[model samples]
Target chain A: MTTYFNEMYDSGKVRPPYARLEDWTRSMPAELREMKQAEAEALFRRIGITFAVYGEGGDPDRLIPFDMFPRVFTSGEWARLERGIKQRARALNAFLVDVYGRGEIVRAGRIPGRLVYRNAAYEKAVVGFVPSKGVYSHVVGIDLVRTGADEFFVLEDNCRTPSGVSYMLENREIMMRMFPDLFRGNRIEPVDSYPEKLRRTLASVAPTKCERDPTIVILTPGHFNSAYYEHSFLADLMGVELVEGADLFVEGEYVFMRTTEGPKRVDVIYRRVDDDYIDPLCFRPDSMLGIPGLMDVYRSGGVSICSAPGAGVADDKAVYTYVPEMIRFYLGEEPLLKNVPTWQCSKTDDCKYVLENLHELVVKEVHGSGGYGMLVGPKSTKAEIEAYRARVEADPGNYIAQPTLALSTTPTFVDEGIAPRHVDLRPYCLVGERVELVPGGLTRVALTEGSLVVNSSQGGGVKDTWVLAE
Target chain B: MILTVDHVTLYRYDRPVRGLVQSHRLMPSTCTGQRVLNWAVTVTDGLAGGAFRDGAGDWIQGWSVPGPVSEVAVTVRGTVETTDQAGVLRGHRELTPPDCYLQSTPSTRSDLALAELAATVAGHDDVLDAAHRLSGLVSEAIVYTPGATAATTTASEALALGKGVCQDHSHALLAVARQAGLPARYVSGYLLVEGDGAAEGQEAAHAWAEIWVRGLGWVGFDPANRCCPDDRYIRLGSGLDAQDAAPIRGTARGTGFEKLDVTVAVQAVQQ
Candidate 1:
């Protein structure tokens, strides 16, 4: 395996734009290093950075592991990535609109309705409601991995409350102090404007009847959610209240949030809760994280929710295969970014091919994320592969197979020294009246050796993403 | 033909709780073709809560907890409905239709408009076609942004902003259907899917809508997916909109936030 640092720096493929990186590394005293590490841990705890482990008993709070080194991207590289993400989000949104609004694609036989309907994320509740700007996925996080210089592949799509943007901001703050000289020497673009951009995007969705300054709030599932810290952090940075389900109510054709002064009219809500749990009356009747009758208010145009519910139908892994076609069909533009090679199990030919190549392909459950329900063919035992094969045979419609490519690696801090770790980047895009891409993104690293899972739910860690100025 | 429905749910918490209590009342009905087969109630107060049902026939399930009780008690009631067609079952409630009152109001809520829309679309070829058109339009129109709107979102508001949750979708369709003079109602049900194992945060209780047609009487339509209800759908209850047949409805004591997770599964049994 190639050593990421050696290949990037010593081999001259890429260099740390920070001129003082070497100097800072040499000058770092043992005591200072220890203090910095201690400080990093403290910052995470102070910020309450955490991710929920599904079955892990007791406290669901697990600090998101952070690395001191921030990944750097030049202005040119960032520009390409920005355009690519925008184009991808636009296309995906368009695809959702077409799939749910019109059966044109399905009629044209490019995709199948059975596959779309079978997708676990598809909601039958949101049939005819149109959003303010004709945008379904307001906040989109597209995970990308670099295979080589100027070569990146789509890893995954997080259209529903994609998190870790706050971590990107917080990580940068800690890294700046840890490597002040390096940061000062580098031309890293400031990611501090993200909260402002996000606020603007959310504010743009405020109801028309509201005053010039619409009351906006961040609806969270509360402190137990793994991304609770990010939710509170973003709400604080954006100057909005962080509200849980009980904090809001709907009545008299308007959506009101329970505040210190009783029910206050809220014009916009930046919610981090999943669609199913957003409104008890509409999606999940038993969900306590949602406000009853809230959906009625949204449908009445009394308020606007960011990244509207049921948008997941578009981001469904089964529907992901037709994104490029959707972009061309809706926007009349070619996709700026390319999707990873994916095979739909619903298709007879695809299923046959996937079944035949079970031992060589990576199989993923259609509705799964956070690296769950995935089988790494090359790394699996014969028994595991056989079980997966049986599962696929039993329910071919629930799985998708893809060839396992050598995911690109980056230099990650380890006990011995900086070693190569597979990494992926998820940059968030905000779409309200317009699309805004944050300068930096969440850089997830596969901490385990030879492991492709970079989700925090797995044993993955993260680093700050730095988009450098030209 | 006799129709039976069973909804089983299991809820697990991160930590064990001290106490738990749950209660639910069924919708008062006087339909002749429907008969209660078997009713069972169970609650696990410590760490996990589970409820199960076994029997036959078309049934609508509803739950209501009176107060903020922690221990989960789920009541499973089965209703057998006799149908003229073989292997084709139907369940109907002819009380004061909830949508009638909502439609009577000259309000501009999205539910009214959506009901009106559903009614308008119901005149189309089939339930599948109408559902497809409605779902497609809603999906195209509404941007999926969380916290944008809540359950009480009005038809005018959702139509104006074009955003909302399943309640909004159901209400909007109900409004549109009412406007078009169609007897459309809301449905609460469990969608059976693969990947919903015990471990992986793999469970969700789902809601949709249903329209009563001439020949078909009442048929299921999912505007969210733009399709007619099929095998994957497990019907629980139907009402004017989300409020009437809410799966779990009741008041609670705690003032702060209350977290809830519901997992439902319906498996086809071999005779």
Candidate 2:
């Protein structure tokens, strides 16, 4: 009776798009599969692609699990997803622009004014100034989950610096290296052009002060950061310099990277540093990882910050409820993808219902990321649920609850052959001169037998998502 | 009444520091009672960045001076013509709603002392009357002492000690006002005290608290001076706390023993 919608199959019959993958999976032996898994791990380690696990006592840099099995999608399915992602990104950027200036959406009574104005994520510093090209979130990573063959829902909107594109690119690289024949036979679209596209996107949003070809640099919080590897990798791939806070300085209405050849004017900074630590003068004064006058220059239009400060408000979980309204309000189009039915604990009725059915609903902190502050209802025990309920009751406004979504499963290669595991996709939609995205995105697999959490920090693995060419 | 101000702040370090970046909120308030005749804020050897009028309706400008320069002088000179309207500020263009100020900051967080202070003026029905009562009560509670409290002192700390400066007065007022269900903020501006009074040497640039009245919008109250702001007060900027509304916020690169010398002269100009 426990039927999970597997992307590759429909009642034991192989879907047309996944037939090739099925044949390949059957042809490979158990020993070869084991060897390939080790090979993938070795490749990942050698390439130095690792994520930092915070608050853990052990090694900080843990390699995200890599599965040899790739999740495939037909061109038709991909085309719809591409449209949805682009639509969502455009709407999100527009929302950021509006919230910072005038807040027409708030005035229109579509979204509650308190949500946009009162949210802690809403940075008051960046208000009233629009960035170059009016683009707020230049790079949008939209997290999507599938329920059925045609049912996809947006799980979250990461308008700020969304990491893990390196995994996407790296997964494909290893896949192509390991199974050269599978790629040659299958007309799969290449995702290798992402870095070039990212570079172009950053270049397109250069500030007005640039007299020459704009200098674009990646602003990293330094090597100790969890996504430092991704930062360096992306910078290398884009042919741009990866800079720390100390490596850059703001001078005379512009940001400059300190080079041996004196200071070079930096027009665009693809900053990986969070909003609070981007500028010490404007935000947290004690932040060591921030340029002193970076925000001053940015507000003055000397340099453009990709995914501008305060764009986080648009992606805040409380604001996520209005994304569909945003799409309609700004784009004048119906939302391409549906959002999961979420109950904001800020609402008294929603909070009451969540308390009544604590074990049946998954509750998450509104501002939490990386899957740290969450309670998966079904998987939790009585003691855990009781503790979480008390916490939620203590501060209901900080939490949001949703039904345990029957997340679609994919045939993933585990130790005991192939088994269905939950998966999610984070498509990096680039917004600059125009909204653009690579065909396929990073597909995170839960790896565990019945786990629904696909976050890499939570024992989840990544797989190559193949979008078949027409 | 036209008041001319000369504010010169010098920072001298024991060792050569790297550099300094500063944002100044020195522009005169745009309310009806106060009009700027002339104003200029300059830094020695500093490169001018971009200038912007912030959401709080304050003119802010950025400046940066390069490294290895030991001494930096930030000089602010201005002349403003002020017409007294009984401390009523009119024609200011702040976009933020009053409710935003209700959100208490770390420095203005209310405690047992603040709750008791708010209780002193609890019976007043009108918010404006209650705000005035709260302001007067704060002045009575915390005796004005020049060096009694540090800049990091919160309202509760000052209330417990029973003595503080203008910054502490503003913090205490903000905490108590918020506790009394009135939206309040810390305001930084130049208060022109005519003649050689106690506010002569280097303390003309003052801090106050503004409470949002239901019918009257934002009304300034200076608990340190035991009076609401009049034409003599040239409001520059306001925020949830004193630090956010700092007239000059900066980050000096490099570390050393920094000796700061400040001189602010606010004299009434007879024109």
Q: How accurate is candidate 2 locally (lDDT)?
A: 0.88
Give each model a TM-score.
0.66, 0.97
Residue A246's lDDT within candidate 1 is 78
Enumerate the candidates' DockQ scores in order: 0.03, 0.66
User: Per-residue lDDT of B1-271 in model 2, one digit per residue for the tens?
Assistant: 8999999999998998888888888788787888888988889999999888877788888999998889999999989998877766689987776667777878899999799889877778888889989999899989888788898998899999999889999999999998988888889988876555354332787989999988788989999888888877888888889888988888788986789998988888877
Q: What is the per-residue lDDT of model 1 for residues A153-191, given as tens digits with 9 covering 90 to 100?
A: 786787788888887888888887667777677778888
Q: Where does candidate 2 stray beyond 4 Å?
A: B116-125, B194-202
TM-score of 1: 0.66
Model 1 chain A lDDT-worst window of ten: A1-10
Query: Interface RMSD of the predictions, in order shown?
Result: 15.0, 1.3
Considering the two chains of model 1, state its CAPRI-style docking category: incorrect
For candidate 2, give the DockQ: 0.66
